[model samples]
Target: MRIGLYPGTFDPITHGHIDIIRRASVMVDRLVIGVAINRDKGPLFSLDERVAMLTDECRTLSEQTGVDIVVHPFENLLIDCAQDVGAKIIVRGLRAVADFEYEFQMVGMNRALNDQIETVFLMAEARHQAIASKLVKEIARLGGDVSKFVTPPVHAALRAKFS
Candidate 1:
């Protein structure tokens, strides 16, 4: 089976993420949403919370696409995580040139570590290109509407977190 891994903190899975997940699912037999357990980022949501949010968001997408979507939390190198999930492709969502620059370096480093795994970049839809989890959280914290950037469940989770 062609398994692909998409790794991210996913503090609160945004619409941008869902867009990528939906698109990526069709390209692989199984799409593993690797939720990173990066403590350095001080994520707004806990690992379990992030995993739960991703799981909830992806259930429908999985059903529609007929591609198995699994949420796997990892605290190790992304390449290692991919290996753990038997992923030969690493899927990444690109929003802008800035994101490309960072991802380029990451791809290089990951290749150096494991040349077998390939990284594929998917450009975010224009509408979702500007939506980010960090910005979503900031807007929610400041009492702004984030309905356009995230799904209802995630928006409710953010509201509950900040409330």
Candidate 2:
């Protein structure tokens, strides 16, 4: 089966993330959402919380796409995470040229680590192009409405977190 790994900190999954996940599902038989445990990011949500959020979102997506979506948590290298999940392709979401520059370097590093695994980039929808988890968090923290950037559940979580 063709499996793709989409790795992100997912401090709280945003609509932009959901967009990528939805589009990536069609390219692989199974799409593994790799929840990265990057302590350096100082995530707002714990690993379990991130995983739970992804599970809830992915369940609906899997039902809609008719593809199995698995949430896997990892603290290791992204390439290693892909290998662990038996993913031959790594899916990435691109918002702008800035995102591409960083992802280009990552693709090169990942290829150096293992040339067998390929990287695929999916452009975010125009509406979601400006929605980022960090910005969403900042907006929510400042009492601004984040309904546009996240689902109700995530918006609620942010409310609860900031409250």
Candidate 3:
């Protein structure tokens, strides 16, 4: 069974993320959404909260798309996490050229670490390309609306945490 890993902070999973997950699901037998722990950027939601939100968001896709979704919180290296989960592919969403530069470097390093694994970049839908967690958090923190960008559960969680 081919497994893919989509790793990110996912402070709050957005519709764009859901779109990527849905698209990636069609390509892989199993997709592991790794909620990475980034010590650099203090997260808005706790690991448990992020996992809960991701789990809830993925449930609908699970039923509708028949993709086995696994939400795991990882503090170790991403390659290690991928290896642990038996992923032969790393799934990533490309918003623009800038994203490609960074993801390219990581992909190179991951390839060096494990030559068998490959990185697949999927272009984000034009409308969702601008919807990022940091941007959503900033907008919502200032009491602006973000209903269109993120899921309802993520919206609620952001409000509760930032408001």
The candidate maximizing lDDT is: 2
- Deviating ranges (above 4 Å) for candidate 1: none
Candidate 2 runs further than 4 Å off? none
lDDT of 1: 0.95
Instruction: Please list the Cα RMSD from the true structure of every candidate, rounded to 1 decimal place.
Output: 0.5, 0.5, 0.8
- Model 3 spans > 4 angstroms off: none
lDDT of 2 by residue, 49-73 (tens): 9999999999999999999999999
lDDT of each: 0.95, 0.96, 0.91
TM-scores, one per candidate: 0.99, 0.99, 0.97
Residue 26 C-alpha lDDT in model 1: 84
Q: After superposition, how far is residue 118 of candidate 1 from its true place, in Å?
A: 0.2
Please state the error at residue 8 of candidate 1 in Å: 0.1
Q: Write the per-residue lDDT of candidate 1 for residues 32-119, one digit (tens) a residue.
A: 9999999999999999999899999889999999999999999999999999999999999999999999999999999999999999
Task: Give residue 110's error in model 1 in angstroms.
Answer: 0.6
TM-score of 2: 0.99
